[model samples]
Target chain A: MHIPDGYLDLSIAAVMWVLTALVIGLSLKKVAESKNLNVPLLGVISAAIFAAQMLNWPIPGGTSAHFVGGALAGILLGPYAGSIAMASVVAIQAFLYGDGGLIALGANLWNMAVVNVFVGWYIYRLLERYSKFGAAFVAGWLGITTAAIFVGIEAGLSASFRYPAFVAISAMGVWHGVLGLIEGFITAGIVSYIHSSRPDLEETSNAVISKVPVAFIGVMILLSPVFAYLAEIVGYSEPLENVAEEIGLAEKQSYTGIFPDYTIPGVNEYIGTLISGAVGVVIFLSLAFMRQHASAD
Target chain B: MHLLIEKTVKSATSYFQDFFIHEYSRKTYLHDVHPSIKLLGTLAFIILSISTFQVKKILLILASVYVLALNTGLDVGVLAKRSSLFAIFSFLIVLPVSVFERDVVYLITFPLRVFASISSLQLFILTTRFSEILYGLKKLRIPGMMIDIIWLTYRYTISMFRDLLSILVAREARRLKKTSHIETLKGGSKSLGLFLLRSFEKAEEIELAMNARGRKISYRGKYRAGFFYILYISGVATWWMML
Candidate 1:
């Protein structure tokens, strides 16, 4: 799931960096405003998450899969604190172990820390009233699958990558979707155990997602396809390439370039790019953000 | 099943243990360079390498990185060996793309760039201590709170791993018979749940301990750029500009 450095173009990487920075900055403020911000607790929990990732669960076959715990972090801590914890873990993985690329750290953090945590938290909160265990299961399952979808979208969007958006999306989405079952189960089991034994620690988060944010997210989800269509109709290419064409350093290979043109074979470029981008956004923004009620207990 | 748990613990322990021990025991000239300079230099090299699609330029950067690694007393073979895992992964991932596009260049350029980038980062980590890197980040004006959290996270990761290893060992010791997959899942969840609770309690204890001592956590470092640091950065800059 860790996208190495060369896999992403500079432009995509920069966009991810900006988005990640924005989310982290907002998270920092949210965490600061909370009365019970425990820095040590956050750090230790981050460490535990990092180490616990080493624990593997047996799959149906003779193989094993490790837990990612992004959703678990959000469930245990609040979304804001959970993002920070996961960011620390991801950063350490890159710096210490070289498990991920340095240049791609921003994208890695965006997918795992921001997208995974928030989405998981949102899913869990939305479904909590129905069933705690089931909510956790879906949160854990969907959180990872969505993150993987983003990875595919990012890679697919990059001209440097060989695969188109759909192939990348399917490969990443399908594999993780299947793996997420185990993730879902483990997350639900752990959450259930903690809830039964230590209910005080179960509902650590008091964030209330009101109808307004839900409506806003719904609108965003609805608008993603429109946005993707409009961008494609405008013949979207790398920003730098636009500059290059303006300066006459590069010719306008709008329709013929491999992927810079954002053309999908068989289907029209607009529809292909639109479908890819829209699906990416729908999966992403569905649980990406939440509005906390000011008076929530 | 116990073998699986033991293998995971041993691997995790070695990763934490071998790194700190390897880093602390070495005192090369590169180790004396200012970490901020090294960090910036590393970022510059990585960006430069990946920015270009020229195989020649990428190879040049890789060679330069290898030469630097060898000069700094790092085993180039080990660094390359570690980085090759990512390179092979990159190659395999891009293989489908190259086959689809019928462009062999993608196969070489992507993996080569990944190798150079990983090698450059590993070189930086090899020469600089984790504390110095944090101090460098602090000097670079990253958030104080982020630095503190990252520091604490690094400090406690080992202790938490030890706790996990112990929990696994204890669980294994108590198991009187073979466990089913469901039982394994239950056991694993129990261990993780217990670990999380223990982590929260330890955090509370540490918070109190820190309050008794003081609240402020800061890293003070005298960052003096040596001749070697200057020369190294200049060389990297020259290479980047040349490309």
Candidate 2:
């Protein structure tokens, strides 16, 4: 599920980068603000997860699948720390093994680190009161399936990818949805075993929501249509522009931005997006920080 | 059952060993190049290569990277072998689409792009130490806390992998009879559960030890961009121009 380079358009990659940085920044802040910052624990658990990934289990039909454990991480640790842990694992894989591409690292992180961890954590939390094993099984299965769907979305949106969005989504979604059963069982087994052995360890999840992240997320959601307008205004069609055109959305309504395609005027689209992305991140972070400070004040 | 156990153990052992290969290698000029510079350059090359649709330029970049790999004392054959495997894997992914679209150009170009990208990345990995790369990320202004976690993860990955090997050996030794695949999976999951518990215990011990020492995990390194770094950048620039 790691996206190698040469697969995604730069625009989609840049958008993912901004989103990932936002989540990681918030996660780091959340982890740091905790009473006891057990950095070592996060590290070791990440290591365990990485090593455990190497283990292949026999399936019924003589095929084997490895455990992903994104949901397991979120269940074991809280979402904040889990995100950081998963991010570290993903980053190491890319740097050391080139399992994914540097250019596409942002999207990879967004998928595995942010989406996988959070979706898994939220699902488990929502379902935990009913049945611990069932929650974990569902979380593990759905977590990876959701992440794979995001990968499909990113790939489908990229002009570099030949397939349409629906095909990509269905392919990745269906494949992982089926493959995720093994992950589900593995996660359930681990959680139930750990619950029986060391119940105290399961109590480490601290999922208290602060006002800042919620407000920041709200602001980001509100900003999307505006950014969408900006994307239209700039006159540079993004990878998603193809989807819009195919759906006839591009022809119906129109808006424009001074910077087309989210790039600075008169600059290379790639570098322009990089510059634009950096500025966008700074702006978003500043807004989030300001909101945080205002609430504190 | 034994084959499964042995294959898992061997693969885990090799996976652990693969992390340390650069640590024991002879130092070349590529080793002297600042990791941050190499990192930035490598990322630039990948981005440029991927963004371009020119198959000719992509092949040229692949050839140039292979030549550089040879000159830098890297095993070109090994690099080719690994990259071709990746290329074939990536090609298989696009096979259905190519068959549907019947686009020969798409079939040819996608794998070549993947091959080139993987080759360039492998060159970077085989040359630089993972720690230096982490430090480079630091220089690149990545969060220090994230870098610390990655370093710790790498360190403990080795330790926990050893523990895992021990558990697998113990499990295999104790197996009284041949088991069905389902039974094997059940046993494996039990070992994994035990492994997770041990990892938690290990974390608690390490945390207490860290608290006692009042030491923080940090990495500090010097980065000097030398002749090779400059030449590499120039080559990248030339490739960009050609594209």
Candidate 3:
């Protein structure tokens, strides 16, 4: 799951860096606001997580699975401190062990630390009201799965791997889902032990539902290209024509349109590209709006 | 099963022990260079390598790194071995790209860049002391609190690793039969939980000791950059610009 340097496109890597920096900065502020922030505690826990990762547990078929512990960290500490702890471990892994690439550190941190920790924390909080075991299991499972999805998307978008987006997603999803089930069991066992031995340590904070809207916006932005690609495949004739030609079918139309290859009829190529993009966005937004309204009703 | 557990514990302990021992014992030009300069230089080289898609530039950087590693009197074979797993993984990752890419140059470029980047980092870690690296980070104006945390973590990790090794050894010695996967999982989790509890307790003790001595956690060191440092930085910058 560690993205080595030169694997990601520079533009994608830069975007990840900016986003990770912002999240880390916010987490620093949040942790600083707490009066009794235990620096050594955080550090030792980070070290423990690092050390624990080396301890692989046996699975069936003579194989083993090592713990990533991102969700476990979030469950032990809150999201803010958990992110910091996981980040330190990740940074050390790169700097000390050369386990990950220096250039891709930000992307790795964002996916492994920020994404997993926050997702796990929120999910745990939401479900803990029902069952502690269920909460821990789901948090661990979904945290890893979500991170894997992002990794798949990153690799797919880079196009360096030549793996189609769906292929990457499905492959990573199935692999991590299996690992995640093991993670879920481990996380639940740990959480249960902690609950029984030191009940006071369990975090009791309510889930913050307000962040959902912001996450929705982020998802919408991320999926914009996918939406555009889908529109091109469905609404336009080029992809169909190409597929038809590949299968030895005759062309439906011999002539090109005014907007050839998604270009506007009378505009410059750049402007036509913009117009086509705007149209795609409008279609996606309208569909989203209708879905939201339908769900509300 | 018992042999597997013993081997795993021993290997983990040896890795921690061997790194510190090797770092402390090594003496070479790289060891003499200021940590901050070495850190910055390595980072610049890594970024420069990663930034380019040309196979020639990547090979140039890799050769330069090899020369630097040899100059440090470090075994290039050891460095290569240490970095080989990631290098192989990187090659495997870009293998599919090679088939899909129209240009043959891309096939060479991606894997070579990964090799260069990982080798450079491995060389840096091999030659640099962990404490010196922390000192360099402090001098670079990293936040005091974050640095302190990293420093503490580095300091405690050695002792915690020792404690963990002992705990594992004790558990392994007590085991009399081949264990099932569930049994191993249960035992591993128990040991991990106990290790974490002990670490937390030790942290509290260290905090109290620090308070009693009225001491603050800070990196104490002098950073001196010589002519070679400036030349190194300039050379890397010039190469990056040329690329």
- The prediction achieving the highest TM-score against the true structure is 1
> Which candidate, 1 or 3, would have the higher TM-score against the true structure?
1
Error of 1 at B221 (Å): 1.7
DockQ of 3: 0.15
Q: Which tens-of-lDDT digit does each residue in A1-297 have in candidate 1?
A: 888777777766776776677677767776776667677888889999988888766666768788999999999997878989999999878877777777788889888997788889889989999998999999999999988888888778766676878998899999999998888888888888888888888546655434554344334333433433344335333344354345433433343432233433444669756644553343233212111111122
List chain B TM-scores, each candidate. Answer: 0.90, 0.88, 0.84
From the highest TM-score down, the ranking of the candidates is: 1, 2, 3
**True-vs-predicted CA distance for residue B68, candidate 3, Å:** 2.5
Q: Where does candidate 1 chain B have its weakest 10-residue lDDT segment?
A: B234-243
Lowest summed lDDT over 10 consecutive residues: which window, candidate 2 chain A? A288-297
- Give a tens-digit lDDT track for model 2, residues A1-297: 999987877666776777788888988988888754478888999999998888877667766777777888888887788888899899988988778888789889878887787788878888989999899889999999988988887787676778887898899999999988878877877888888888887667754656577456435533533442343344233333344345432332232442357764445779867755665455345334322322111
Tens digits of per-residue lDDT, candidate 1, B1-243, equal 585595586567767764564465566556766788888878867776777666766876787677666655667887887789989988998888688889898888988988898888888877778888888888888777777888889889878988987988898999899988877877888788888888888889999998999978878776546544445545443333322
Q: Give the runs in model 3 whose Cα sits over 4 Å from its true position.
A: A203-297, B1-4, B21-24, B100-104, B166-178, B236-243
